[model samples]
Target: MACSGCYSVNFMAVSSNPNKPLTSSTLLTSKLSSSYSQIPFSSLNFNSKLSRIQLHKSNTAPNSFVVVSGIKAEPLKVMISGAPASGKGTQCELITKKYDLVHIAAGDLLRAEVAAGTENGRRAKECMEKGQLVPDEIVVTMVKERLSQPDSQEKGWLLDGYPRSSSQATALKGFGFEPHIFILLDVPEEILVERVVGRRLDPVTGKIYHLKYSPPETEEIAARLTQRFDDTEEKVKLRLLTHNKNVEAVLSMYEDVTVRVDGSLSKEDVYTKIDTVLRNVLGQRQAAIVLLVFPCDMFGISTA
Candidate 1:
């Protein structure tokens, strides 16, 4: 059955005999409601007083979930950290596409709030216009609401631009959330500035391009590239300063669980290194295995 836009399959078989009542060889095909509260049963066969019951599924199920003899499932949690212009967004896009992990970007949330004319967005815009920081509670509240959504359950998630302060980190812990891995993208300040200043956004599609690193094909289209007001060198420098100070403080508060990657490298190279780090952290055979288990294919889902 499909729940939260994803399909899942579950089945159970029961026998009345106490000994040799159920075995793996017992064949069963039954249709069951997806809800956990409802239990579905098929005809049962037993040799002795029902001692045990077993469940089995055919290969035709779209998403097969079998309960082992004795094992528990754990939720996957991950956090992504980087300074401005460090290509965190680009890398996150790749990771989310490769693995179904939900990508929650703080900056995108703030931008969307401001665009939507919400009270929080209005306050944030005022703070931005005055060159002041938005209050932490507002940001944290937004993030908490986003995480509480039903879609975040079971699947893995990649959180970006959150826990900007050690206080926020402590708050997250109090809320019963801890990241399994924390990734830091280490890019040189000069290179980051260059990348930021050269960047342009297509107003229609919101596609970002860089004049030096990823230019458009035609000169006419390239000429149409528009630079963001905040992408100026001065703004980038200020953002970098604030980010370094905040991130350093936050990192110091947490235990040693960070893996730093040089963001100045090519996109593919960075992805390779990140994939390796995630595999090691998650103890998965490959990054694709993690992705297949965490699929985040929804749009307009608040990553706040």
Candidate 2:
């Protein structure tokens, strides 16, 4: 590992040839010691930061794990857009986990503000109660407040369902939140309608289900399912139409960094394409493997 103060370990896997990778043959060539006072796994901490440590506990090798370290990546800013039923939630969950990012769905943030009853929330409530759309300034303020938080500053953020118009898109850039990439999940309007119509939500568990694609696991859950008032086919169609009409404005601003993904594919396939694009944006990471050892072995010098 490149980290300083890491020399306390008793048995560092000092590679004979740093350029050549260690193979099973190399392990077999040496007479392995059966009793070295094996280290526990929980005590090792490699100071090097690489995608939130991405720790993987190995079952095959009880006392060992491969440590991956590299130049820490920049705070990633990913902006994604899709129709209401385009599986944004599922993809956001995956992307945020894989990249170690904060998920900032603008709608969620606005709702949270409203729930907290802050000054912004109060104004938003007035507009909402009066059946008027919340002003762009209110939405932008909520988004900016969220982006300025410590978590967002350190972990970066996945901006979802934001920048609905050219003014909003420009406003984000003005606030120094220019996105690294703009991803559009393109699903047909007909499929969007189909997905919305079949969708049901379990209000108690807050779990969503689709009648055709992914149904309730049990009859009890099915009986408890409720569909959102906005999930009706008419509203879904209008949402899709608005998304299509205004997406060009956002795309035009970020044309150089824009990537459109096929939302019709299986979730796994869709994520594969997204992962590839995000990796490209992240670029090459200078990495090395350090043998993970517990505190008893890794922290103290062996007198023997």
Candidate 3:
């Protein structure tokens, strides 16, 4: 199904059990060699080929979105999937800075709307005050609008929320929005609860800090920092339960391409792992495209 809104030709995984190291096939190696053969073997080109081959042989490999020659690179659209308070916001902040990608946090958007007195915000705020989930249609419409923005066309985007169900995922697909990567942050329930309880927000700036990891200096000052009423232990548990259930269903739709990162690790460590995975995935896609374009010529096989 085509998206009913304006059509923009905006160009845009995983594993598990014991997490075995990914191995690329020898076929890819042979194809890569052939791909190089098709190009003029000047000294510069030779060195380039050697570097490319070595890069491809590293532990990293591409996930999807092969980069083809002469094809403009599309902005990467990524979905960060995890339970509430799973450090997703932290990771996104880092990623957007490093990669120049747009960050769209659905909760923030809805909150802003409520602050701005928008109709949708009014409706969503009412539901939130009552502890109800906002309707999926309202959420999806907001997402569509966000994605259609001018900045979204230029900079790649990280979607922080707003696909809480299988139906929303299906709707996104119909809208021609397929994420190149779906990252899941796996953290233990006990740790999550502790983190949630320790969290404090600066109501003036909305900056979040944790008493343990990122305390506000003095106890007097930190004590003044407000803890969200919603962040209470009982509420955190309930939210986590609901998040886990919904995430499980949403993840079922993306079994093959999902990459799970250990949120238990230090924030820097987690970011490093994710960055490595993304680079590998991007490189693999590039290699595939190069091989595809010069298949016969690269391998010394006559297709004519």
Candidate 4:
């Protein structure tokens, strides 16, 4: 076992008589004593800025001071885009937990501003009430404010369904909120349409269910299911068409750092692929072991 503080450094013993080769401990103690005062401890890699120097004598051939520098990686800034029913919500939940990031849904933020009745919220409400899309500047302002918050600054953020248009993309850059990576969850158009059409929402519980993929556990809950007006086949088809036309343009804008994931697969499989990419971007070693110790021996767990 190697001590965290110090390890043996072995160099080949040089001597004509193999039987009486120079011993490392004897040579080091005698030769290094005077030189030690001139040798700056700060220059060696001991994993710490202030390392406690210790010399270990081992029977092994080669041993030297080992330094393990702790790496604190930069926070993640991610953007996710997908059509409705592409499972961005589910995947975002997994990503937030795994990476310790904040999830910011652009649509949710707009609604929240409206709910708060702020000046910008009132303007957004006027447009929404008239069935007109809110101006790009208004949405961008809200996003800019949200991203500047202390929580977002500290934990980083995963932006969802933002910069839907080219102008909005420019606004994002102006605000200095460029995403490190853009993840596009791509599903077949037919599959997206099928998922949307079969989806049902529980008005009371706000729980969503899919008649085909996932139905209510009991008939009683089934009775409470309601299909959203937007989930109608005609409306869903229109939405899909619009997404198809614009999604490529948005994706191309971030092609340099974009990663496309197949959302048509099982949710777990999709997430596995996503997790692998995230680990690479975050500079995590896949083979490294993480040991977590709890108080009083209550728990001792290791993860890789």
lDDT scores of the candidates, listed in order:
0.65, 0.69, 0.66, 0.66
Per-residue lDDT of 104 in model 4: 90
Alpha-carbon error at 297 in model 3, in Å?
A: 15
For model 1, residues 1-304, the per-residue Cα lDDT tens digits are 2323222223222322112233444433333223121111222232223233343321233233222121123445678888778998899999888777888887778878998999999988776544345688778777777766666655767888778878888887888777878888999999998998899987667788888888877776776788876788887787777777788888876558888889999999999999988778667422322101111122112211
Cα-based TM-score, every candidate: 0.68, 0.65, 0.70, 0.63
TM-score of 4: 0.63
Which residue pairs in model 4 clash with each other?
8-63, 8-64, 9-63, 9-64, 10-62, 10-63, 45-67
lDDT (10s digit) by residue, model 3, range 242-294: 77778888888777778999998999999998898788767765554333222
lDDT of 3 at 30: 23
Over 1-304, each residue of candidate 4 has an lDDT whose tens digit, in order, gives 4334323223211111111334333222212212221122223222213332233322221232211222223468999999878988778989999888989987678767886998888887776544345688789887888888988877889998877776778788877888888999999888998998899988778777999998899999999899865677777776666667777877877889899999999989999999988878776432231211111111121111
Q: What is the TM-score (0 to 1) of candidate 1?
A: 0.68
- Specify the highest-lDDT model's number: 2
Please report the candidate that would top TM-score against the real structure: 3
Task: Give per-model CA RMSD.
Answer: 13.9, 10.7, 12.7, 13.2
Error (Å) of candidate 1 at residue 54 is 9.0
Writing each residue's lDDT as its tens digit, candidate 2 over 17-108 gives: 11123433323121113322222323333342323423232333324332332233458889998887788878898999899899999867
In model 3, which runs have C-alpha deviations exceeding 4 angstroms? 1-69, 129-131, 217-224, 291-304
Clashes of 1: 13
Off by over 4 Å in 1: 1-69, 129-132, 217-224, 284-304
